[model samples]
Target chain A: AQTVTQSQPEMSVQEAETVTLSCTYDTSENNYYLFWYKQPPSRQMILVIRQEAYKQQNATENRFSVNFQKAAKSFSLKISDSQLGDTAMYFCALSGGSYIPTFGRGTSLIVHP
Target chain B: GAGVSQSPSNKVTEKGKDVELRCDPISGHTALYWYRQSLGQGLEFLIYFQGNSAPDKSGLPSDRFSAERTGGSVSTLTIQRTQQEDSAVYLCASSIPKGLAALPSYNEQFFGPGTRLTVL
Candidate 1:
């Protein structure tokens, strides 16, 4: 079984500031993947970033980046230059041998101008 | 028309009524997934269909929930008896199979707009 955990229920960030959301996952498989998805008010889920477990380097997409620690099983998302549009629900997911992703409870991020 | 699409974006039903949600995955994609997101909760996996293989129904909450993919293109999730607890946003996603190289990006999922089901 795979489990993903996001301890923070809500986070706030000022415009142009940076915020980091914490996430940790547990899986028996050595090869796996981690992802961060953002759900806006429209309720459409958009992929923010993805990281392969085997990769030593972290993954980044524009202002969105991930700090992935394979041994510690920690994958956190950091958003730089936060904007009002970045306010949304962020979910962390893990997919391994099953190819089925298990998602975290989600962290509601609010960016204030 | 290019991404995953779901119908009846919003549904309102009374308790004990049955509801059916539909999903149409992207063309040529062989993997489809259904998930449920309740108020202030994370997404709960409902079921998964990969190509012609049997769906992984382990994540289904109960017998009341069932899904089927026909011709590996379209899928429908049927709730036998609706309950207030069943009220949530149902999401559908589709992705191409992971190629032999196993590049993680190749299997990235494309999600639909989602259907919000409200049971009274």
Candidate 2:
């Protein structure tokens, strides 16, 4: 079984600043995918970014990027130029060749102006 | 384009009653998933459906829960003899079916707003 862990329960970032949320997972499978999802006040889950385990290069989506260290079983998300809209509950997930994904306990992020 | 949608954004039921939550995935998406989010359990996958393959119910917490995807599109998660602990936000997600040559990005699962179920 694969387990994802998000050590931080809550995080805060000043407007226009940057914030990095940590995530780690335990999986025996070699082929897998990692993802970061955001859920806002509307309670809609949105995909932030994704990283393939085979790709050592980190995944970047504009302000959202991931630092994926396969050897260390770590995948952290970095939000640059954070805005008020970035304030939401972030979740880290792991999915191997299967159709289901295991999610971590979300981290509530607050962007303070 | 319309995104994934779930009906009855909110539902309230009494203990021992049965409840059904529906999910309408994005058009053309061949994969659909059900998840439960609560204060104690956080987020947990309940079931998954991909194309014509057998749905995965490994994450379901108990036998009281069951789900079915109709015509490979809409899915319904049913909970029998609902308990107070079953109260939570039920979320649904969908993605393109994974093929032998499918890219990782194409497998991204888009989620619905979710249904908040309260069992009192």
Candidate 3:
């Protein structure tokens, strides 16, 4: 079984600054995927970014990016130039094949002006 | 033509009452998933279905919880003798499956507006 861990229970970032939410996962399978999802006050789960295990190049989506170190079993998300809109609960997840998804406890991010 | 959708945006039931949550996945998506999210907690995997086959049932919390996919489309998760621990937001997601040539990506899940279940 694979388990994902998010060390930070809560994080705060000033607007226009950057913040990183750390996550680590334990998985035996070599072929897998890692993701960051954001849930706002509305409670809608939105995909932030994704990194394929096979790809050494990190995944970047404008303001959101991931630092995936397959060897270390660590995958962290970075938010640049944070905005008030970025305030939400972030989750780290892992999956190999069509199996069940494993999620970390999640980190609550607050962006203040 | 639409994204995933779930009915009864909120459900409140007394203990021992049975509740059924419905999910309508994105059109033409063969893969569907059910997950539970408690307050201030991560998502808990519940069940997954590919087409009509459930290759994994390891996530279901207990025998009282069961899910079924019909016509390779809609899905329903039923909780019998509901317990307070069962109270959470039930989320449903859908994705396209890998076919003979096209391999599916693991991320990119289209989620529906979840059904919030409150068991008392």
Candidate 4:
């Protein structure tokens, strides 16, 4: 069984600043996918970014990027130049060939103006 | 293009009653998923459907929970004899699946605004 863990329950960052949310997972599969999803106040889950375990290079999507360390089983999400709109509940997930993802307890992020 | 959609944004039912939640996946998507989100459990996958067939239903918490997809488009999750512990947001997601040989590159899932189910 694969499990994702988000150690931080809540995080806050000032507007224009950066914040990094930590995530780690345990999986026996060698090839898999890791993802960060955001759920806003509207309760809509949005995909932030994704990383393929086989790819040594991390994944980046504009302001959202991931620091994936395969050996450490760590995949952290970094938000650059945070904005108020970035405030949301962020969840880290792991999925293998099965395509069924295991999600972590979300971390609530607040961007203060 | 519209994303996935769920019906009855909020449902409140009493203990021992049955509740049904609906999900309409994105057109042309062959894969659909159901999940439960709560403070205690966070987010947990409940079931997965691949073109009206469920190859994985291991995540269902108990026998009280069951789901089915019809015509490979819409899915319904039914909970029988609901208990207070069943109170949570029921989420639905859909994705286009790659060929069986290319499962690693399966497309990202699109999610719907979940239905909040309250079992009192």
Candidate 5:
């Protein structure tokens, strides 16, 4: 079984600033997938970025990027030039051999304009 | 085209009543998933369906929480004897077949807007 953990429950950042949300996971499987999802007040979940365990390079999408340390079992999301619209609940997840993604308790991010 | 879609965006039911949530996955996507998110919490996997194979139900919290996907496209989650704890946002997601290719994109899941269930 895979388990994901998000240590921070809440975080705030000013517009144009950068913030990083921490995530850690444990899995016995060597091959897996990691993801960061953003849920806004509208209750819509939008995929931010994803990292494949087999990949040595990090994953980035626009202003969102992930620092994945496979050896440490850590995957953290970095949001650059944050905007008020970036305020949302962020969840980190891992999918292993079972193909089922296990999510961590989310971190609520508030981007202040 | 359309992303995964869910119906009855909001549902309020009595504690003993049963409520059914619906989901329509993207076209041609062979993998579907059900998840629950309580207030101020992360998502909890509920069930998963892939093609005609038997679903993975290990994540279902209890027997009262059951789901079925018909015709490999639409899915319904039924909660029998709903309890107040059952009140939460139920999310649906669909992705391409996991093993279709070795590409990581195949595992990307597109999600629905989610249905908020409130048990009174």
Candidate 6:
């Protein structure tokens, strides 16, 4: 079984600043996928970015990027030029060929003016 | 519409009562999934529906939980004799067979607003 862990339970950043949330996972499977999801006050899970275990290069989506260290089993999310809209509860998840996902507890992000 | 839609966005029921939650997947999507998010906890997979095949109910927590997909479209999750521990937000998602690459593979998932259930 795969397990995802998010060490940071809360994070705060000023508007236009940057912030990073830490994540780690335990997996024996060589082929897999890592993801970060954001849940705003609206309570909808929104995908931030995803990294393929086979890719050496990190995954980036506009203002959101990830630092994926396969060996260390570390996948962290970085939000650059953060906006107020970025304030949300973020979750890390792991999956492979199987569609089922194992998610981390979550990290609550707060972007203040 | 364009995104996944779930019915009765919020449901409150007394313990021992039965409750049902519905999900309408996006058009053309062959796979649908159900997950539960307990307060302050991460998502826990409940069940998965792939095409017309019988759903994968491996994640169901107990015999009281069951689900069915109709005509390969809408799906409903039912909890018989609901318990207080059943309180949580039920989320629904759908995707194509090849995975997210068609979704641009961002490993993205189109999620519904979720049905928040409170068992009293």
Q: Where is model 5 more than 4 Å wrong at Cα?
A: B98-106
Which residue runs of candidate 4 sit more than 4 Å off their true CA positions? B104-106
B-chain TM-score of model 3: 0.91
Query: What TM-score does chain A of model 6 get?
Result: 0.96
TM-score of each: 0.95, 0.94, 0.93, 0.95, 0.95, 0.94
Please provide, for model 4 over B34-65, each residue's C-alpha lDDT reduced to its tens digit, 9 standing for 90 to 100: 99999745688888888746458998999999
- lDDT by residue for model 4 (A54-90), tens: 8999899999999999999999999999999999999
Residue-level lDDT of model 6, residues A11-91, one tens digit each, is: 999999999999999988878889899999877788888898999999999999999999899999999999999999999
What ranges in model 2 sit over 4 Å off? Answer: B98-106
lDDT per residue, candidate 3, B1-120, as tens digits? 498999889999999999999999988888888989898788887888887665456789999999888898999999999999999999999877555633243747888889999999
**lDDT of each residue in B11-97, candidate 1, tens digit only:** 999999999999999899888989999987888888989889999898899999999999989999999889999999999998876
Clashing pairs in model 6?
B100-B103, B100-B105, B101-B104, B101-B105
Candidate 6 runs further than 4 Å off: B99-106
Alpha-carbon DockQ of candidate 2: 0.56
Ten contiguous residues minimizing lDDT sum, candidate 4 chain A? A93-102
lDDT of 3 by residue, A16-110 (tens): 99999999999888789898989888767888998889999999999999988888999999999999999999999888764567889899999
Fnat score for model 4: 0.61
Q: Per-prediction DockQ scores?
A: 0.52, 0.56, 0.58, 0.63, 0.57, 0.54
Per-residue CA lDDT of candidate 5, range A58-85, in tens? 9999999999999999999999999999
Query: Is candidate 2 or 4 superior in DockQ?
Result: 4
Candidate 2: clashing pairs of residues: none
Q: Residue B119's C-alpha lDDT in candidate 4?
A: 86
Please give, for residues B8-89, the per-residue lDDT of candidate 5 as tens digits: 9999999999999999999898889999989877888899898898998988999999999999999999999999999999
| Model 3: lDDT of residue A98 | 45
